[model samples]
Target: MDDKSLVLPGAIFALFSIAMIWPPDEFVSAGATFEHLFYRWIGDFSLNIVEYQLRKILVNRVCVACLPALFSLYIILNVPPTALSTFVATAGLASMIMGLAYAFYTISTNFSQTRQVKELALYGGDVHRLMTEITQEYLEFANFAVSFAHSSREVVGSHWLIHITRFDFTIVNLTDVVFEVVRSATVDLNIERPNDQLQFLIIEAKIPHKNIKSFRFRVRTDQFRDLQDRVAAPIGMARNVILHQSLNERFVKAFVSCIDKNPRAVYSRLGELEPCFGCSSEIPNVKIEKRCTSIIEGARECRQCFCRPMWCVGCLGRIFAAKQEQERPDIWLDGQATCPTCRAEFCMLDVAFVVAEESQLDGNF
Candidate 1:
């Protein structure tokens, strides 16, 4: 979840309460109590839903983040000023109560969506249409920075595909090229949750292509290339979308703008708003989607854009491996791990492939 969204509600509630209390207003004490009660209620709600194991999570969030805020109040109220530890403990307790409520809020919101999807699906309603409506009305009506996709994973829930957006598909496939070179990234989601819905969404065109499609790539937390050195392409935030075949047409148009400029151009130059941080050996290629989007260009070039795979089906491409993908040429080679077509020397990662002959050392060891 984006930090901004998570904090918005609480910030609003806190500020509103403060506004009423300022300048010795009529509601100062009431407003303070209201603020406390509101947050505490949210904390309680979250705690109420927590299972035996997940309860710890609620406590941790309260103690680590929420408690500090409350302790500030404690320092101001204590006679002769209590010890820092006293303040800390009181704040922690207060924050825990508030955090519990927030957790409960989250659980309720998630559960509401799950129920909505289940009820809608049972009636044979269209998941995509519902997703579009919810995203437009509830998710990103004002915040273009936000986008949503409908996705479901077999783990932890039923066929719930409703997720808020920030998806991108085209850039992901391009990134996969680098991932394959790094020798990391095992396509486990494909094997484990074959039917999970995954969509890539891009917000307004900060990078020129609006309505970018979700990066319909599988998450492979297991595979790690150069694990010892932490040398691999940056993994930007990617949500788990239920595996889907087709994406929205508006989404397609946005992605389409980023594709080949020339008939010969294979790979698409998809861009991203949120790139990874701290690592610089490899550039943030911001990947793309393939399966959900049509590949006017052939395999090697097409796969460079994050080509999403179909349900229970996968492209045995080299994006996850060092070997040449049998079906497609290495158009997706924009990673730090030099591509097979390296003779072009800085061929610009998003450009079409220039197939080079296999060169081997004079003698094999």
Candidate 2:
């Protein structure tokens, strides 16, 4: 038998046994004691019920529930001794009626809005809306960048496309003279639980080409805020950086060394080839001289200002460090950094390392 079934009968039998087994003289005193205890239990139960009803009324603001509760309280306070039992029973019945009525009202309201509830469940409600808004904003930024890149024919060398995803961005360099080079890189904005804040992940890097690698960095709120401010403002001068061959070589060496030490950090194994804007090398080459890395690692580049002289992570890091030294040499502070070529503010952490080919990393070997 279920516990409830056994427990219910057991309780009843115990109460009956207690009543039947008492001695005659002691029975009278026992009856008085039992009556007192029963009244006390009833009072406690009634108080708890009243407390629950009041809390329900406050939380739900159900006018129907409030009226019955208030009437019950009034009857309890004013009803004469002769009619106390009847009034108490009436109050309890009112409370029950009100509870049922409130439940019915809630059920009917939910049924009426079934379509809306279903839609919200399917589409993720607020989360979906947030994603849509972010996508639209990024699209507008990309269009503006593309337009600017086209207008400044001399400074900009390639057409770029920025693909917006839910949590990351894929930037593809679309300008290739001979054939379309699938040279692309990904910057992951790691939006954690609650999705309010974000971190950066470099999923792919193509410029100043080195092996594909991943690097993580922390993002500051002010730096994020600066990026947002730029998008909101009128499109201004597109920043372009042209890196010399000597500097490019130095950066490539640093990148290769880092990759050698941390082989697992290189996430992509794509064997794609693209002429480095800085060193004129087909990236992901065994030779560091031929590999080129993109200028802005984590930040999306403006298509109009995306030009040659791309630098690897090491070069960019040096430049950033130098700028910091020049600005505030004594006090160390990690704040917003801008592209040397374009003067556009970006989160350094979001910059990714690039590999020439992505398919090779698919475990074919």
The local distance difference test score of each candidate is 0.31, 0.35
Each prediction's TM-score against the native? 0.20, 0.18
**In model 2, what lDDT does residue 179 have?**
17
Residues 109-182 of candidate 1: C-alpha lDDT, one tens digit per residue: 75344333344444346655644443333222121121112221111111112222111112111212222221
Question: How many clashes (backbone atoms < 3 Å, residues ≥3 apart in a chain or on different chains) does model 2 have?
Answer: 27
Looking at model 2, residue 72 earns an lDDT score of 48
**Superposed Cα deviation of residue 18, candidate 2 (Å):** 99
Candidate 2, 1-365: lDDT as tens digits = 22233345446644643443322345545653222333432243223322222233222333333334544444446544445435544775677577667657645674233322232233344633533343344334223231111111101112432332212222323221111112222233333322222222111223223221222222222222222232332222112311122322333355445434321213233344443332332232222221223554443442222323355444454455455444343321232356666765543332344444554333322
lDDT score at residue 139, model 2, on the 0-100 scale: 36
Evaluate residue 257 in candidate 2 and report its C-alpha lDDT on the 0 to 100 scale: 50
Best model per lDDT: 2
